[model samples]
Target: MSASDPRPAAPRAAPALPGVAGNPRRPYVRPMAGWWLRNPYFVRYMAREGTAVFVAAYALILLVGLVRLAQGEAAWNGWLEALRSPLSTILHLVFLAVFVFHTVTWFEVLPKTMPPLLVGGKRVAQSAITAGAIAVAAAASLALFGIVWGLTR
Candidate 1:
């Protein structure tokens, strides 16, 4: 117990309990393998999350398309032609379905994640909020379609 002592003092021991068991380990409970199958909500949530894989695949496809486009008109045309193949069409259909599922689920969960929204001094229904969001999305999509159509024409 001198100032020159470089070694740290021994740590205080934990107080011994009178009745508590030593080395008490938690019991292992087996997880339910098919828990999601038993509940519709769980299935829906899992499906919603699974759409992320398709979304990522679609993003990569788009990135490849962009890369092809950058290469030249020939490369871009080749990529476009490849997209017209049956396999590509099927994949696109699957991606579209997954995208729709993701979007709908996102809207459904949005209200729960947000604080209660008030309109006209009353709390707005979740359905109303979801509908409004979908409406806005549809409008934006139509606008983009129009612009693209006009440019193509």
Candidate 2:
């Protein structure tokens, strides 16, 4: 009836199932609980996605340290001292493991996400692409570490 369409409005009722004899009800919805557990692929995908929580936690911890540094040397020292605790060390170890897994999974999916790369009219292998990416990341990390260490010394 509005300015958009010339046809009459369709019925507001839910569409009936084809085999249902009586009046139609809402469409059936499958249970969502434990869906990720049913498939190995889903499990790996969920685990990869779930690592974001730990990433966010570490980011927040660094953010707090920045805030403490801005407050003064005393506050910054307190933050540094807190990070030296046994609990903090254990938490960091766990974060390291999770980060390693997350990085590997992220790199594994990089080839699927990007357009096919043609090398001399042939497509490059995914394993090569993934290994190249990981190598680049490790080299960058090492260079950064060396720079920082040299500066600190």
Candidate 3:
């Protein structure tokens, strides 16, 4: 409060500009809320990032199952029963869709995120790289499913 103080005075925040009319020279500030909804690219980016929450939730569910398994038969059976519920089945389907969206979006950006691919002194197309990665993922998923089915049978 006094000039003798070594500390500088606190700076004032800019007044809210809700149409009261202020300085004409002030730079225009874009509204931050719902900006992603206006652009398809940002919408897709947000949705892809949002899928991580579902992935984490699924991982937690699996961790809980592991804990229940370690607790012995009754706890393990209870966890299995919980998963067998209609709600859990529907939730798993929703998770599956979100996971597929996440995977596709991730692969679409793979070319940009990774080094260029070349074969026989020729660069591969981005679409080819995306398609090849998706194809490989699908094949691996199918192979794993087949192995699980064989074991369960």
Query: lDDT per residue, candidate 1, 1-153, as tens digits?
Result: 888999999999886554456735555666889889988999999999888888888889999999999999999999999999999999888887778778888988989999999989999999999998888877888899999999999
Task: Report lDDT (CA) for all predictions.
Answer: 0.89, 0.94, 0.95
TM-score against native, each model: 0.77, 0.81, 0.81
Q: After superposition, how far is residue 115 of candidate 1 from its true place, in Å?
A: 1.3
Deviating ranges (above 4 Å) for candidate 3: 1-27
Cα lDDT of model 3 by residue, 1-153, tens digit: 898999999999887665556645556688999999999999999999999999999999999999999999999999999999999999999999999999999999999988888999999999999999999999999999999999999
User: What value of lDDT does candidate 3 attain over all alpha carbons?
Assistant: 0.95
Query: 131 in model 1: Cα distance from truth in Å?
Result: 1.2
The positional error of residue 13 in candidate 3, measured at the CA in angstroms, is 20
The weakest ten consecutive residues by lDDT in model 1 span 18-27
Q: Candidate 1 has which clashing residue pairs, if any?
A: none
Can you give the lDDT of residue 129 in candidate 2? 92
What residue pairs clash in candidate 3, if any at all? Answer: none
Residue 48 accuracy (lDDT) in model 2 = 100
Q: Considering every candidate listed, which one attains the maximal lDDT?
A: 3
Worst lDDT window (10 residues) for model 2? 18-27
